[model samples]
Target: METHKSLSPDPNPAAEDDDHPAARRIHRLALHLNPPQGLHSHGDLRMLACAAKGKQLDVSTQELTEYMRGKHRDVQERVYEYFNSRPDLQTPIEISKDEHRELCMRQLLGLVREAGIRPFRYVAEDPFKYFAIAEAVGSVDMSLGIKMGVQYSLWGGSVINLGTKKHRDKYFEGIDNLEYPGCFAMTELHHGSNVQGLQTTATFDPLTDEFVIDTPNDGAIKWWIGNAAVHGKFATVFAKLLLPTHDIKGIADMGVHAFIVPIRDLKTHKTLPGIEINDCGHKVGLNGVDNGALRFRSVRIPRDNLLNRFGDVSRDGKYTSSLPSINKRFAATLGELVGGRVGLGYSSVGVLKIAVTIAIRYSLLRQQFGPPKQPEVSILDYQSHQHKLMPMLASTYAFHFATLHLVEKYSEMKKSHDEQLVGDVHALSAGLKAYVTSFTAKSLSICREACGGHGYAAVNRFGSLRNDHDIFQTFEGDNTVLLQQVAGDLLKQYQQKFQGGTFAVTWNYLRESMNAYLSQPNPVTSRWESEDHLRDPKFQLDAFRYRTSRLLQSAAMRLRKHSKTLGSFGAWNRCLNHLLTLAESHIESVILEKFIEAIKRYILVSALEGGSFAIHKLTEYLSFQVRNIARELVDAFDLPDHVTRAPIGMQSTVEAYSQYTQYAGF
Candidate 1:
């Protein structure tokens, strides 16, 4: 193991002089930002405490660290034992055949009773309310956790609101009580991302007053469905609604609808007569989740099974929908998926928060090289160390703030039923989820390295956190796929402006963009001047607004021009590059702006208290830290280290040595 010597920059006489305008300005900004107080705050940190508590096991941080250091077999055994021993702490309710389903439901309900949190009430609380309940059920694994969380969050509240009184009466209570574990099966093996191309069909059967659900081929089977393999008895399956006539074929033939299909027997845990289930097998991470594939062979469900928020059918085979446009209807259904993306982003934040805490705490305690004549200094004192870790710390804070803002926006949009706002939320959520998860993957690894060899040790939590977060980038929707959506939306906005002939708007955007590009080279260094610029509030606000607008406009132009030279598929392929760039820029702008706002509002408020004065100092330090690491973090997004450095970025021996020095203080 090798350790780098910590270098303390020589104090500038000018910086020490309080009377100096630069020093005063820096101090003022710090006071204004109101940084974090001592290590603890507001009755233990919400992020860490929540995550630690979610594991259900009362193991201390040290115990967790030791567990990680032990053999893989030992770790797995402990993990399973911890979960199985406390069925009361976490429930594993599965809905299958009559007997098995009833037994599991009773077991789950008993656990719920022990927790003293009602089924309905749990649905309305944090883990459940926010779609993180899967995290509570430790053995469920990440895949199942995410799937369950998404299903519960979507159906727990909105489903009840959207369904008819009869539909609600039949399933809502059972679902709330975990008496009927349900699967939200939408993604097909052949067309996971391309939902419009789904081949599963639900034809109206007037004779039985039921819809005949059929998966025409192997591709049509529901894949990667959590709980579907073993736990789910019923599923909210999405299929195309094939109307009787071709007159409405273009629209109606392509009509995608949701149905509540029974997939398994309640007692025997057997697949229904026509249904088949296969466990998805092992994955890179999220093993607790029982991801599975399901094939429906002419599965039958009553007409009333349709979750007709936007469209419905009568027993007479008559079709009706308030939304005339099939696109709009599709949007409404797909829009529900946005919550999953948003929740994943927040979860990433939580995970990153833990990583940052571990890295930061480890850095503070672990000492490294110093002058040969002196004691070793904390590695955190090195600029290179700070460069590696602080930006991630800043990013963690940035993501935290961004997620809270997004959730607030989503909550309001849901309350007002604002379509425009909903679109914005969808776009933003997609972009942020892609951006945050991608960065989290990189950032977690960096934190691991920053900790040196200790980071590789399972006990530090970095390895598991990294492994758990690995799936986030690809699941829900792949980052690249989601970014394409963001890019597509931006391109549309660009097309609108171009067609509208908003020359002034276009020129203004270009000019601001140029200014931002130029400003990056010669960032304002005068603390006093920059402080003045930031304090104007309007300037800071406009900076982000302008940056986002310009990035969108520029990317749109590039994509449009690139598309013009190619066919539709080619155009889409070419546009992806530009789209990713723009989406990243937009997400970065949001994060920075949100961080600034949180600092101003929340941090500043605490500064007025005498006991809270240290917070102001911490805020000042973090602000400077952010400024110092901004370029590196941005570089991380643009040119990931993995791409730039071959074996260096791959899991390498360097990371091992780095971790060794960090923890063992070699």
Candidate 2:
């Protein structure tokens, strides 16, 4: 951390020293500085000595991670310890798929029993705390994370959101107490993002006061359903609710509704009558989830089985819904699943953090070619290595704040049933889920390559991370489909502006575009020309805003022109790539803007509370010394040694080297 002489000539090297208060603070944390030798320039050796000692920014790292953890640190630590203490809950060593599934279920049931009626239980009261549990599980083994999410976040959460008091009374206690297991049967063999297109049907029978559910064809079968292979006793099945023949008008009028259908027998763990369930044999990863498929011939359920939150069936076979139209009702019903998207976004960022943490720490310990007969330099000292991993490190930090903001916004939206709020949250969550997952996918790939041969090892964790997280880009919602959803929302906001309307945060780009287009003597683009412009929040914000506005404005124009000639669907398909770009740019702008806001807020609060100088200096490094903030930002992810589980990412360089040498028999 101590400033040293430069290897390359500088007119005023002290200027670099003057700008970095973080280096000064981190310098004090360094116990000693020692340089390994052979014919290196005195100045170069001095710099190497500093670099060797420089990774220790103990206070800054802890403060930032503490800030990230916020009020949930105590609960997070307790949960981490609970999982750590239970070896059975941990991933096994090279087990077969059957063994993996069985062990995973046993571990899941243990967690359910342990977390009975608590925040980590079925339908958790605190969304952040619930996500924290997912994050911690994902850090060590994502297969376990997916299994846990299926049980609590997706299946149990559906009952909490879509079910009424009676439904809750019948299911919630059992779900919380592990008396029954479940799956969310939403995705069909042919229909994933297009939930309305699912061919599963649930027809009402007035005489029997029941609903007959059937999967009409192969395409309608529920597919890739977690917990369906072995454990689930019930499924929150989504299907088109049909009225009696006399009451039917057309297909569009009938709505998709959720029903609590029995899938497996409780005592024997067997499939119920008319239900055909099969295990999806092997996957790229996440084998612990027991992914499976299901088809129903003629399953019957009591009328009260319908999750009657948004739509319901009358005793006389009439169809009624609180939502006015099918589309609105679809939005309302699907809105219940937004929490899963939000949690996925947060969990994706955590995955990237884990990947980069392992890569960066390995770079610091793994040595490579240097001056002949001299000690080899750490790989991290190379510019090529830095270029590959540093920006991703910064992005990891940016995504951290962005996802947290999304979580907070989601929490606020949950309190109100306003249609506008629901739509807004849906659009935002969709955008973030797509952006963060894609980012993590690419980041893990880069991190894997960055670590060279070692990264390919299962022990290193990147291989599993890459394969398991690859599904994230497609499931929950397809990334491309979700991006298109965001673009459609943006177009809606664009049209709303003419009607004297605006949305919470997205509308800014529209307003900014209009003002920029109409301004006298257009604003200069040279505002970013200065050497320090990258460090200026205003310059960064303006650049992001302008790029987002230009792309969106152009996208809207293209859609309009093409639609007039090719028709709406044809034009949309033709311009799909542009629309995707528009959505991506807008999301990137949002993340950078949110990052600036978070840093500003932390700085303001720290100043007011008279917080630690180290934390204050960390903020200064984020802004003023932005060029050198890579290591600090990565450390801010606050991944504990236990969570990393990589020998190279242990507590200290010494600890990592100690374990590595022993393992290598050096």
lDDT of each: 0.59, 0.74
Name the regions of candidate 1 deviating beyond 4 angstroms: 1-111, 118-151, 154-158, 246-254, 495-547, 567-569, 604-666
TM-score of each: 0.70, 0.85
How far in Å is the alpha carbon of 269 misplaced in model 1?
Answer: 2.5
lDDT of predicted model 1: 0.59
Candidate 1 C-alpha error for residue 136, in Å: 7.0
- Indicate the residue-level lDDT of 362 in model 2: 84
Q: Candidate 1 residues 1-666, lDDT tens each? A: 111111111134244544565654444445334422332245235334433543222213343233222232333333334445564433222222333323433434443454333334434333224332333332223433454464465544445544667777888777766767778788899987788888899988777888889999998989988667667778888899976754645334747888888887777878888888898876665554556898888888888888888888877667888888889889987775576677788778756655665565556556788999899987776756765666565566567668867777676666676777778788888888899899889988988898787667654556656776898998778999988877777666556554663322212343345445434422222222222233444454455556566667566556567667786678767666766777777666667667666656544211111111112223333333343333332232221122112112222334634644454466
- Among the numbered candidates, top lDDT falls to 2
| RMSD list, candidates in order | 13.3, 9.4
Question: Per-residue lDDT for 2-119 in model 2, tens only?
Answer: 2443222234534534786565333322212311122123644544554575453223666777787787666667657777888767775477899889888777676656743243
Q: Which stretches of candidate 2 lie over 4 Å from their true place?
A: 1-59, 115-124, 247-253, 371-374, 509-514, 517-524, 604-632, 657-666
Worst 10 residues of 2 by lDDT: 608-617
